[model samples]
Target chain A: MASLYLIGIGPGSMDNLTGLAVKKLNESSVIIGYKYYINLIRPILKNKEIIESEITNEVDRAERAVLEVLNGKTVSLVSSGDSGIYGMAGLALEIISKKNIDIDVHVIPGISALNSAAALLGSPIMNDFCSISLSTNLTPWNIIEKRIMNAAEADFVIIFYNPKSMRRQNGIVNAMEIIKRYRNESTPVGIVKNAYRDGQEVILTDIKSMDYNTIDMFSTVIIGNSQTYLYKDFMITPRGYSKKYEY
Target chain B: MASLYLIGIGPGSMDNLTGLAVKKLNESSVIIGYKYYINLIRPILKNKEIIESEITNEVDRAERAVLEVLNGKTVSLVSSGDSGIYGMAGLALEIISKKNIDIDVHVIPGISALNSAAALLGSPIMNDFCSISLSTNLTPWNIIEKRIMNAAEADFVIIFYNPKSMRRQNGIVNAMEIIKRYRNESTPVGIVKNAYRDGQEVILTDIKSMDYNTIDMFSTVIIGNSQTYLYKDFMITPRGYSKKYEY
Candidate 1:
């Protein structure tokens, strides 16, 4: 049966691609993705037919993939990070359901930015954590702020995706202010830019000293919980081992 | 430089192993992990010296891995999910730091169970979400309950890791009661057991009708926020796209 495979390429590097993801991509007859993501996987795309579209045209891209699948072509819709998390899988499934299209949609998970950033920044997410996208394009700023405030109050290791953009100048700063309401000023903050890609940068700072000027859409920001601390250059949150077991 | 590598072998299947993780496992001279996890990766451990320990002996396993690295042997400490999240990375680093062992530590991230579960259950985590483990072995029950309540009140999609075990029977039931105080009883809940492995089961039901009997340590439970719904056997949470764009 022909199917539409939603594959996450995992930080845009072939090294991070899972063996299942690579096999599905190779088996796909056609590939569809945002223009930037398409270029990121160009090295492995070989002879597959590629369809590039604008980032804003997610619905259109999803509809096109479903249409191709219905036409008996194996389609691979690519996205960075896990396709199920803030990626193309949701939109594609919505389109298929609305159109009543008969097709098999397989969502293949990958290493999201949260995973890559957490690895670089030690174990900040070793415990409970929440992730909220700071981009207000699709979600309202007020809703985003409320989520951040609640997560902060709960002392979750908070992760902010798409922290800053060209038009949205004050999102990260505003988020930090809300976070400071419940967290200490010295809480560890990890900023990872272009993770697992070229020009990758990992910065460790405190909530009070975080430099938002260097953050952009390509970065993922993590604010550690109250228990998080820095040992040498590594930012770590103990997984309750110190309290439960003696070293 | 001799290094200790912490690798997450995603879902304990060779297919889900990333290319980088596979390379590191192959390059390492010694591999160490929990007894169950070591058995899961037996196919790839043809030539490497394998060391297995009981699940309760995480500190002992971590210390042994660090000792091997200090003795100039390349070692890989394997974990089932993203190693930085509830894995051996933090314990090993803590041991190395305390013992004043000078060795390079590299954490290779993989697809966590949450990611794999979300993919199988559709995109229930497409929006803002948080994950909390139900195990109270290390964390106090009060703290765990508070985090679940706050996440529920904030309407963040909640993922529960280690939802149940033989000894702890009432954790999931207690968690569901707290969540019901904030969310509607009809809220979507997805239970994925042994995701991407043998005997995998995906169940989509409502909060009022969830069956805890089928859940175990290998399962991941996702309780969707107020906005999540089930459409054609797929549990989905909108990414605020329907409100932002006309589809």
Candidate 2:
């Protein structure tokens, strides 16, 4: 009866690792993750066998992680942002469900990329907004396009994750094009580079002025719908109170 | 010059508190928070003078938190949800901007009611969603109505904070009416009771079946817009996928 702990260690900071999460990490006999995440928590691993895999091999990583846990090792798998968001929890559980394994799995939620991004950008997420990943790894392009269109049409404040990567990166451009397909071009867009990490940079731009090429694997982009506004050095996606409050 | 640390202590779980948040909390000498939240973290506080205040006395709490810092006590004003999100940071800064206070005010981020509610109900917030508080105490209904209309029209998943209290409870029905004004009556809804607490209960319903009377101070109600669907065991809001993926 091996148990697997799928933990979401809040965005990058070491202190973000909850005391419970750190305890769970210390309890694990083997730890599996992408190389960077493994290295991030290496100091506290405490005699746990570490399996550091590449980012692209998430499915492979899960398969190996499951096999190890099934072999009676207390296993802990990690992801940077909350595990459920873009992490491997869904896929892992899906695999477990398929295998009919009765193993117990625990998911520890971490601070997601957007939450950190939103924090760095000074609360653009304070209003009503939605988050979408521009990655088509498991999700398709046409659906992503429609989601973007629907979100923009819904006048949602948008937070985009997985904006771009090395090989397949034009999703941001297509996403913006779909957003502009329904929303006004004058909307404000805020970008967080390496959010919650050292050398974190924040840039505010307009919807039409977005430079797709400048955004890479480390950036999170937030686009405000038509009703979103800025005041006193904060970007606000007003949920319609500006006119009513003025009086 | 005295410095104020605006730390973002995550949701109720100690694991949710980040390393940065701990450093800030420990560095402060005086802590001010609503009674409920103060009770949660009282055991962890060390060398700090704690000020437990009720929710209604926010301005007074903020004033005292700032005043103590101004009086040379390293002060920390804590908010349960993200400090800046519909909480004290904005108002405190506004008051500080109006006065000549000599202390530095730091706004620490805490997990907002949104993520805490979402975690209880599996993946209702998966793709894109926005939150709007229907409370008229600080915001006018006209703005609330427009935001609801915009969010409903946008088909973004919606989470309502402070849905109903003793006096302003009418806002929930008004919000439902406004949402129904722009959306279908069959959209799925989820109400989380005492989210993250011991007696946590999640009720999955729809716009047609929602009743505002069941909600009170301890509950967090999440209403999914047009695209949100109700599964038997889970409240599934489509990120526009799930059809393509073989389940």
Candidate 3:
């Protein structure tokens, strides 16, 4: 049986790659992913056939991976974070189902940007947290706005992926405004750029004074809940231990 | 400077260990964790001094790690999932902060159970999602209930960690009831037990007919949002590619 592996190579760093991910990538004959992701793993793709495509051609990339698998090539479709979360796994499965392709698909989980960012910024996500992507390319801005509003109202430690981009300037600022209505302007916000990768920058700022200019498409923004606080230089969200456990 | 490492050994399996994690563990002079988690990493703790403690003694275990570090021993405090997310990272940091301990603490992120569960059940968490631990040990039930309600109301996919236990049998049931108020009873729900570990099990069912008997403390349950759907044996939440792009 032909196998198509959807592998998440965490945060574009060799240090973050799991042993299983490295083994599977080594075993795969062909690697398919966006040009940036492909180049990120170029050091490991010594003899493997590489298939690169533009970022906008996600469906096409998924279809190509499925086609490669159907053609009897063991293919690995790569994504930056956990492939099941806003990655290539969904698209590949959808393509396979749509075309009635029979192939063994396995999703190899990897550390997500949220996990990497949370570790770098201390434990801001120690309790209930929700992730919202601010990109308005696939999802409408109105829908994104509603999610941010409800998440804020719910007091969820909100993590924003794709928070800002070159063309979409006001997306994150608008989302922050919605969050401000529910959370205090003094709520701690942690912004991480290129987590675990080169040129990494981690900043702990309040929601009101957050510098939008520092955030880019490569950055992840986390808006702390009402209970989150800053401890020294680290952002800490108490896991109700002080309230429940008398330590 | 004495070093204390807080490591997340993903899903309690050697296969999921990252290269960096393995290196750090090998370098540590002592391994400290809960009994269950310590046993999970026993295979790699050949020469390291093992300090196993009961599950209820989280603060004690963290303090012990700090004490070991203070004694000039490189200590590795291991957790099952991402250490920063409801794991030992916050507890260890709190202990250090309270005591004003000056030790170099490094948190190594790992593949969380939520990531493993999402991969096994298809891409049910491709969009915005929230994780809430149902255990009321450290957090009040009212807070957990409110988070569940808000997550469901916002239509964010909900992942419940530590969903059920022998004494707390009604936690998940109560959580589902809160979700039912916002989402339909027929919404897709995924239950994964021992994800990526021995005796792994994955079940996909709807919110109305989900079998509570099958869930336990080891299980991670994911309740899909309004946009989630089931295709064949797989659960999927689209990232809005089909609605936005024509491939």
Instruction: Give the per-residue lDDT of model 1 (tens digit) for A1-247.
Output: 8999999999987899999999999999999999999988899898999999998899889888988998999999999999998999888877766667778889999999999999988778998999999989888888898899889988899999989998998999999989988999999999999998899999999998988898998999999999888777688887787786777
Q: For residues A1-247, write the lDDT of model 2, one tens digit per residue.
A: 6788777676767765666578778888888999988777777877779899998777787788889988898888888877656676555665565566667676666677766776665556655566778877656777666667666665657888889988777788878877777777778888888766676777877887877777988888999767555444455554333344321
Those runs of model 2 whose alpha carbons end farther than 4 Å from true positions after fitting are A66-72, A96-101, A140-156, A168-170, A174-188, A205-213, A224-247, B63-73, B96-106, B140-155, B170-189, B203-214, B223-247
lDDT, candidate 3, B1-247, per-residue tens: 6689989999988878887788889999999999998888798889989999998888888889999999999999999988988899888887667667788888888888889899889888998899999998887898888888778877889999999987899999999888889999899999999988889999999999999999998999999989888877788888888786665
The residue ranges of model 1 lying beyond 4 angstroms of the native Cα positions read: none
TM-score: the better of candidates 1 and 3 = 1
lDDT of 2 by residue, B1-247 (tens): 6566555555566656766667778888888888887776776798688889887786787677778877877877777657656666654554454464556555555556666666556556665566677777755677667667766665667788888888876878888888787777887788877755567777888889987777887677888756555544446555433344443
Better of 2 and 3 by DockQ: 3
DockQ of 3: 0.76
Ranking by DockQ: 1, 3, 2
- How close is every model to the real structure, measured as TM-score? 0.98, 0.81, 0.97
What class would a CAPRI assessor give candidate 2's docking? acceptable
Name the best candidate (by DockQ): 1
Residue pairs in candidate 1 whose N, alpha carbon or C atoms collide under 3 angstroms: none
lDDT of 3 by residue, A156-195 (tens): 8999999888899999889888887898889999999998
